[model samples]
Every structure is written in structure tokens, then in C-alpha cells.
Target: MLTKTKAYALKGLEGQAVEIEVDLTPGVPAMEMVGLPDAVVKESKDRVRSAIINSGFDYPIKRITINFAPAETKKEGAIFDLPVAIGILSAYDQIPTNCQDGYVLLGELSLDGSLRKINGLMAILISGLQNGYKKYIVPKENQAEASFVDGIEVYPASNLSEVVNHLSNVSPIPRLETKKFNGKNETSKYGVDFADVKGQLKAKRALEIAVAGGHNVLMVGPPGAGKTMLAKCVLTIMPDLSFEEAVEVTKIHSVAGVLDASQGIVTSRPFRSPHHSITVPALIGGDRRAKPGEVSLAHNGVLFLDEVPEYGRTVLDSLRQPLEDGVVTISRVLQTVEYPACFTLIGSMNPCPCGNYGSKNKECTCSPSQIRNYIGRISGPFLDRIDIQIEVDGISFGEFKDKASGEPSEKIRERVVKVREIERERFKGSKTRTNSEMTNEDIKKYCEVDRESQNLLELSFAKLGLSARAGFRILRVARTIADLEGSDSIKVEHIAEAIQYRSLDKKYWK
Candidate 1:
């Protein structure tokens, strides 16, 4: 007898259909698995046999063959265990062969016949839905997250026997009740707020603009100048995630195996702060399985790097391509995978070796050579990609002791949400959502400045010796500033504020 069961394997962030073909014939009592399955899939036979026997079913002592069809895509993980076992049981007529004709089976079965939770279940289910497979049989442990995927009849089963019962109609497993996705995710509650920070109004404003326009930011300051605090407060001022954007963010997190099983979806934006010692592969996403790294994990959110100059130059430089393209592609010998990395890069570093090069109250202690070498660790090309580079001076004694809190993040987020709405209307039906993502064609079409603003841009390029790319960046930021002020055109003040951000490159890196 031959039987087939439907299953799914993760291909990057999307799901690809996989068919489990199980064949049984009268011969020696041996079982073999074919198709391009990894070592884990090859080992599922033992677990499946033990599960079937333990679940009060007969494990056929006959020649058995299981194939994860297509025979090309590399299949990893134990997501195939339940499907393989189901196919085997169907071959013996223990369960109706047609029961799994319309369902995607996903789970890992233990020797005791209990089903355990598997990774990438959400990714597989969502991809299956998009590809027009609306029914799924997932592990009961993953029922919460599975409930959020609408239009899918998800049957959550506890073990192999329960699944077999559901298939046989002796005891049908109840379908999971779908949960409504709220905009605010209750899993990750953030207590940090902008009002908690003491000072650095300029840095706070820069961060607001960075989040408002999805631009990258770099903060130069002495130690304890609130740069890190400002970076952490960025999410507080960011706009709320839309449903579509939330799905994209959740899909990436799910495939990365970091999704909160209890929570249905990810509503809050991500904030990934990798250590300075991170490797290129770890930061940019590369491994034996080609899993998503920090950049992809921080999709639609912030990638903060504290003490940016202390990071490895190679690792810092590796981010240039992902920052420019907003996606990281990891290629292997057989398959290539891509993960979305559209994140805001916010980095903070000191002025010099002594960390007081440009301090107002303190004198500089580092020499020019030390300063140059320290800043040199951050490459010129990397700095060019950052749209806002502002200096964060330490707070004065009077300002620190005033006991007056700055503006709350809630108020700042209102302006940010309004500006984001403007961009959404402007870029409707297109992929361009923010100012930093605009191409030269977009810049010419939407980021036009008047004569005075153009003169300021040109003078900055000539006097500061800025690159042509720098000119485009300044315009993008200026357009963001204009949008914030409800101005139809880029004003000179917007141009000046945007150029002021670029002045740090000449100030420190010169």
C-alpha cells in the first residue's frame, strides 16, 4: 500500500510544500528513508516506530520506505516526524488514508507518542495559507500562535493517538478558536521612556527624526552622556505597527525560532543591540542552516550599537550592503535564502580615546592621532550610510538637577505617527515607505528644494568636502524635516538642520 501526507518545510521566511510518501510492502522488516532529508529526518524512523507502538497501534514488521518528496530541497528539523508516522499508519489502514488529503501535518513525536512543539510552525502555517493551503494539524503546544493565523482550520493535537482519533472520527479534535491580533503586543512591555532621560534635547530630537523617516543615526558623545538611553527610547517614539507590517515582522521572528509561543503575533517593533565582538556571519545572517541573524531579527525596528567605534571594522563594514538594500541574502552550495533587514541603525560612540574630545566642561586628553585612529575603525562608507550624525554633550549640573522631565515619548510618538501616515499616503501602492529608502529617482521626484536650500546643500558639499551620496542623504533628511513641520517644500531651516547632522563627519573623522 502507498500513502501520501502533506507537510511544509521552511524556505527562508516562506513555506514550501513537501509531500511525505510512505510505502509498505511484504518483505524483510526494514525501514528506509529517501529524498534530500537531513540527519534529523533520517533519525525520525526510530521515533516514529516507537511512537506508533507506544500509542497502542501495530508497528508493521515489513519493508517500509518514506520519502520527503521533491528530493532536492534540504530538509532539516524534526517537523517531518508526525507526517512520516501518519503516512506509515495509513499504509496499515489504521487510519483513513484520505483523512490528511487537505491538511498540513507538523509536529515532532516523542517515543512516548506525545507531540512536542516545533520551531517555525508559524512561518510554515502562514506560508501555507498564502500558497492556498488553509488547513493544518499543528502541535497543541503551538495552538496560541496558530490561532492568530486567520482563515486556517488548525487542529491542535496532543499526541499521536489523539491525532489518529481525530482522523478516524472516533474523537475529533476541536479546531482552535482564532484570536484577534491587537496592535499592541502584550508579551514585551517596555518601561523605559524618553521622560526618564535627563537631558540631551538635540540627541532626542535626532532620534525622533530617525524613527520618523526610518533613517540611520550615529551619536558622538562623552561617557554617560545619555546616548544609550536615547537609543533605547527610540522605540517609544516609533509609530505603531500595521497589521501587514506586523505579519512580516512576526514571520521573520517565527522562522528565527524566537517567536513567543504564548503570544499570537509580534506587535511591538524590534530592538537588536549586538555586541561589538559579533562576527560577520552572525550579524549578517549565515550558518549551516542559514538562519536569520541580528539584522534580519531587527526587521522593521532599531539595530543599536553602543560604543560603535569599539566594534570590529569588518563586522561594521559588513552591514553596508544590508543597510543599502534592506535585505540580506545568504547563499549556500545548494540553496539561497534571503531575510528582510529593513532596520534603523542607531550607534553611539565617544569623541576620542579619553571620551572627552569635544566635551564642553571637560578638556580633551587624547592626541589627534589617537582620535583619528579610533574614529577610523568606523569606515567612511559606513558613516556615509548614516543619515543623522549628531553630537551628544553631557548634561550641565543645573540641567541635571532641575527636576523637570523632558517631553514624554507618547507625545513624540504622535508626531511620528502623523509623519508616517504622510509617507504611507505618498508611497501608497509602492515599496518606498520611508525617506531613507528613496532612490535617486525618488529624491528628484519628491525631495526638491528651493534655491536657498539648494545653495546650502551645494555649499556643504564644497566646503565640507562631502560626497555626492552625502548630498542625497542631506536631502532625504531635509525632506523628513519638512514633513515634520507640515511644510510642502524643503525649507532652508530644514536644509540647515539636515546639514548640521553631517557636520560631525568633518568634525571627528577629519
Candidate 2:
């Protein structure tokens, strides 16, 4: 007898349909799974066998051959355990096969037949729905993740016996109701607030512009100048992610297995702060399995790199492609995976190795050669991609002890949301979400500068010897500044502030 059940195999963030076909033939008692399965899929046979007997079902003594088709792609993960077990049981005439259609089965069966949650359940469920499969049988623990997908009947089962009971029409398991996820209430609110930072009005203004334009920023200052704190606070001031953006960000986290299972959907903009010692592959996304790296995990949010120059040259340089293309494509020998990396890069570094090179209260001990070499770790091309560069100074003792609080993130966020709305209206019917994503054509179309601003920009271009990419980045920043003030055209002051940000590169690099 032969039976077939539907399942899915994940390749990167997408899912490919896999049909689990089982054949029960009269021979020596043995089991085999074919079709390019990895070690985990092959080992499912033992799990399924033990689960079937423990669940009060007879393990067929016939030779059972299970095949996962299409026969070319390699299957990984234990998600195929349930479908494979069902296929074998149906082949032996223990359960009906008609119930398998229009349903996708995925779960890891334990030795005692209890269903265990598996990673990438959301992506698989979305893929199944996209492919016209509306019914899903997943582990009960994964019911929350699967419920995020609307228009689907998600039936979660606790053990193999429950699934069999449902299929046999003896007891029908209730389908889970889709609940509207409230990200605002579920998001964490314990992080650093903008009001906590004592004083750095200049740095605060630069961050507002950066968030408004979706531009990358770099801050240079000594330690304890609130660089890290300011970076953390930026999350609160930035505009919230749209529903589509949240889904994209959540999918990457899901694939990377970093998502919180209890939080069904990601609500807040992601903030990823990887250490400076992270590898090139870890920053850009590459490994044996081609898992998502920090950049991908920061999709539609921020990628904060503190002590930026401490990172290896190769690691910092790897960010150029994803910074420009808004995606990272990692090509392995077996497959090519594309991860969405549309994130705002916020990097912080000291002026020199001693971190007191430009401090008012401290004197630097590092030589010119050492300072040059230290900054040289960051390549010119990488530095050129950063849209805003500002130097932070330590707050005076008086400012630190001041009783007055700075502007709250809620106030800043309101202005940011307004600026984003303007950009949204400006870029309607287009792919871009902010001014930083604008191309040269977009600059010409939307970022038109008056005669005075053009003259000022030309002079700064000549004095700074800025590259054409740097020139465009300046225009993008200026446009964002103008947008923040509810201006339709870039003004001279906006261009001047943008030019001020560019001067830091020359100061540090020279």
C-alpha cells in the first residue's frame, strides 16, 4: 500500500513544497528515507517509529520506504517528522489519506509522540497559504506563530494520537482562531529614553535628521560621551515600522531563530548591536546553512556598530553592498540566499585609539602615525557610505547635574513621523521609504535646491573634495533636514548643516 502527505522544506526564508510518500511492502522490518535528506531528516525514522508505538499505534513490520520529493533539493530540520509518520500510518491503512489534501503538516515528534515546536513555522505557513493550502497542522506550541497568518485554519495538535483522532473523524480538534496582534502593547518599553541623555543637542539634532532621512550615521567622540546611550535612544525617536516592514523584519528573525515565540509579530523597529569583533560572514550573512547575519536581522531598523574602527577591515567593508543594494545575497556552493538588509547603519568610534585625541579635559598620547593607522582600518568607500558624521563631546559637570530633562522621545518621534509622512507622500507609487533611498533621478525630481543652496553646495564640494557618492549623500541629508522643517525645497542652512557632517571625515581621515 502507498500513501502521500503534504509537507514543506525551508530554503532560506522561503519554503518549497515537499511531498512525503510512503510505501509499505512485505519484506524484513526496516525503514528508509530518501531524496537528499540531511542527518536530521534521516533520523526522523527512529523518532517516528518510537512515537507511533508509544502513541498506542502499531508499528508496521513491513519494509517502509519514505521519499521526500522533489528528489533534488536537500531537506533539513525535524519539521518533516509528523508528515512522514502520518504517511507511513496511512500507507498501512491505519488512517485515511483523504484528510491530507488541502492541509500542510509540520512538527517534530518526540519519542513519546508529543509535538514539539520548530523554527521557521511562520515562513512555512505563509508559503503554504501562498500556494493555496489553507489548512495547517502544526505543534500546539507554535499555534501563536501560525495564527499570525490570517485566512488560514490552523489546527494545532499535542501528540500523534490527537492528529490521528482528528483524521479518523472520531474526535475533531478545534481550529485556532486568528487573533489581532497588538505590537504596541507587546513591545518592550524598558530601554534608554531620549530624556535620560544629559546634553548633546548637536548630536541629537543629527540623529533626528538621520532617522528622518533613513541615512547612516557615524559618531566620533571619547568614552562616556553618551554615544552608545544616544544610539539606543534613537530607537524611541524613530518612526514605527509599517505592517509590511514589520512582516519583512519578523521573517528574517524567524529564519534566524531569534524571534520571541510569545510575541507573535514584531512591533518595534529592530535594534541590532553586534560586537566589533564579529566576523565578515556574521556581519553580512553567510555560513554553512547561509543563515541571516546582523545586517539582515536589522531589516527596517537600525544596525548599531559601537567602536566601529575596532572591527576588522574585511568585516566593515562587507557592509558596502548591502548598504547600497538594500539586500544581501550570499551565494554558497549549494544555493544562493537573498536576505533583506534595508537598515539604517549607526556606527560610533573614537577619534583615536586612546579616545582622548580631541577631548577638552584630557590630552592624547597616541602619535600621528598610530592615529592614522587606527582610522585607516575603516576603508574610504565604507566611510563614504555613511550619510551623517558628527563628533560628540563630553558633557560638562554642570550639564550632567542639571535638573531639567532634554526633549522626550515622544516629542521627537512626532516630528519624525511627520517627516516620514512627507516622504511617503513624495515617494508614493515608488519603492523608496525615505530621502536616503533616493537615487540621482529622485534627487533631481524631489530634492530641487534653490540658487543659494546650489552655490553653497558647490563651494563645499570643491573644498571637501567629496566624491560623487558623497555629494549625493549630502543632498539626501539636506533634503531630509528640509523635510523636517516642512519645507518643500532644500535651503542654504540645510545644505550648510549637511556640509558640516561631511567635514568630520576630512578631519579624521587627514
How many residue pairs clash in each candidate at the backbone level? 0, 0
**Per-residue C-alpha lDDT of model 1 across residues 1-510, encoded as one tens digit per residue:** 999999888878867889989999999999888875557755787899899999999999899988877777647748888988999999989898678788899999999999998877777887888899988899998898888888889999999999999888899999899987777522235778888888778888888898889899999989988888888888888877778778888888877788887886887889999998899888998887888999998998889999998888888888987898899999976579999999999999998989999899888888899988988888766897899999999899999998989898888888988888889888888889998888898899898888988788888888898888888999999989999998879899999999989998688666
Give the runs in model 1 whose Cα sits over 4 Å from its true position. 185-188
TM-score of each: 0.97, 0.97
In candidate 2, what are the lDDT values of residues 358-404, reduced to their tens digit? 89978899999898888888877688789999999899999989999
Model 2 lDDT, residue 44, Cα: 80
lDDT of model 1, residue 191 = 78
Error of 1 at 499 (Å): 1.0
RMSD of each: 1.7, 1.6
Off by over 4 Å in 2: 185-188
Question: What C-alpha lDDT do the candidate models reach, one value each?
Answer: 0.87, 0.86
